[model samples]
Target: MSSKRDLIIQAAKQTFLKQGFEATSMDELALVANVARRTIYNQFDSKEELFNAVIIDIWKNVKPYRPEQNDEAQHNPSKGLFNLGMAIANYWSPPIVRSFLKLVIVEGDRFPDLPRNFYRLGKEPMIQSIFDYLTQMKHSHLLKIDDIGLATQQFIGMINEPLIGLGLIILSDEPDMQRKEHVVQAAVQCFINGYQP
Candidate 1:
């Protein structure tokens, strides 16, 4: 059973992804959600707020690595990084997430804050999680990372550019498990080679 709020958010996500923010209407969202328009107002004051909620809702489901929760990240840099890489690859490779990203990019010019909010609330936290994990590894002397920010971006780029970035531009088949593992492994090895103390 879905709560009215959940239903509204789900409807908003699909609608916003399919239609840009300016084009999407509260009435349409209510129709798709199978709720009255007032139900949306009860949950969110405005479309902008609902849009932020949609981004927040998506990230809420994502389980990013936390150093306290995952001790493996502290002791084994390679294994931890591979897990991180796979998580990033898997999350972004999905059609829904990609579509949401495309929506933000396309609508960014008209709704200037859309992309910023998306990044600040959604991607920034994920990036910061990785950055924090890498900082922990550095502090533990597990990896010799002088510049945590650059290293974090490098590892993420290695996984994302080949796997997700390419898909964003051209129609392409999703990489199989073997290919994903290869990319993660190569990234982990390259990171280890450069940063290992």
Candidate 2:
């Protein structure tokens, strides 16, 4: 049953990517999922809610790194910060997220509330996660400041600026690991530079 739900989500994602939100129908979603039309409603109350789920799924593999659970085998400040950078990279590099970027750019007006939902699931988690880690860093004297929210946006813009790409990401013929690493490295360094006392 869970697998069926996953399948429906995957199909919905593809459907949304291929056809803008305004064009996709529940019938099309059912066809792509290979499920009965009735089954989709059984699992999802509305297309909007289900679309929000599809967007959330793009970042599902990257869980929020809870320090209480994760600090058992932690390392120094630099290494810990670097790991967070890699996690951000991994979370945003997926094909699903890439398609999601396109949908946001092309269909921004069609689904008025989607941007809020996307930010709610995506940036909200990143903001809280960064705040938690920054609080720990604060106590350790690694960072000498408050105003985590503004700092959060700055660091995100650093690591994510290239990916932002005017709200689009273009995959080159070859995957560029060097380019990928550079964004994370620069973003992490930006935070360190600002916080160093």
Candidate 3:
């Protein structure tokens, strides 16, 4: 990501956060980005294109990955599961993640295609990550999953159960540690109940 692109996405996020997706215009983005109107068009062809870019940028940043734990997990499988719970909990609790999610949910109906695109780019990666982790656990003989897909669903359900309500946006009430720890512990416990060998 170029610095300019980052600037544009940040500006878009601010614009979307303030004015929302429907009201935000390219001119507003340009003003916020401190670039010329033509500069915005040069980077993005249209408002819809700019929205897609901003949405992708946000999803990519919050994407879950386990590069740090992968090598260690080659020897210790349990650590991978623990790391995943922590990552998922932390990923969801971030203010930016919550903002993007709220934007998508709120504006999803106006742009019918947006929900599909966001689901593909955002949630699919998390599901695939959990599937891979479960596969590794099966391979390590630490867990026995009759069906990886179903197990993945269980993992996601546990992680997301608490976030199903609208209260996901109300972040100031709880300490960050407590919020994430509760999610992490719930996720790990549920996963183990279904996956323990």
Candidate 4:
């Protein structure tokens, strides 16, 4: 069975996704969660805290990278980068993430921490992971990257633009797997062409 906290977070995710942060009320959350209003206060001090918890919950789908343990990254930079790009593309191309991003854009002025926490917890770590992977590749003499940070950002930008940015701003449907593959492959190819020793 689900714990009360889990139930509350789940309810909050659905509610916040539907009604957004400003419009959602603790009383409605309690009712939706099938718990008392006090139960919510017991679990989360305020609605903002609960909303942050929902963001954290949503980010749980993002798997962290440990470059040291990744043989593919160590031995094969092209394959590894393509794999990483695909992972990033798949994660951010969904409707839930798109909706959450829209919510952040809408409410970031009122709750500044929303976008900060979103990037800090989600994008920063992923970027850092890619940075570390690039550092590893450079050290191993697999790739000749002079600036790992810029390369990491460039690689990520390449994948994120078509997969996430287009859909978030103008496109309505998610890019198909073939499109994702093409984007990642092109990113890896361009990165390798630029950085290969």
Candidate with top TM-score is: 4
Model 4 Cα lDDT, one tens digit per residue, 1-197: 99999999999988998898899999999999999999999999988788778888888877755556777667998878877888788778657777888888889999998888888777788888888889888898989989888998899999988777757776488889999999899999999999998
Ranking by TM-score: 4, 1, 2, 3
Which regions of candidate 2 deviate over 4 angstroms? 1-3, 67-75, 163-176
Per model, state how many residue pairs clash: 0, 0, 0, 0
> What lDDT does each candidate get?
0.85, 0.73, 0.74, 0.85
**TM-score (C-alpha, index-matched) for candidate 1:** 0.89
Q: Candidate 4 clash total? A: 0
Say what the RMSD of model 2 is.
3.0
Give the clashing residue pairs of candidate 3, or none: none
Which pairs of residues clash in candidate 1, taking residues 3 or more apart in a chain or in different chains?
A: none
**1 versus 4: better TM-score goes to:** 4
Candidate 2's residue-wise lDDT over 112-192, tens digit each? 688777777775786687777777777777777688777767766676667545435464332257876887787777778
TM-score of 4: 0.90
Candidate 1 ranges beyond 4 A from true positions: none
lDDT of 3 by residue, 132-161 (tens): 878877887878789999977877667666
Q: Give the range of the ten consecutive residues with the poorest summed lDDT in model 2.
A: 166-175
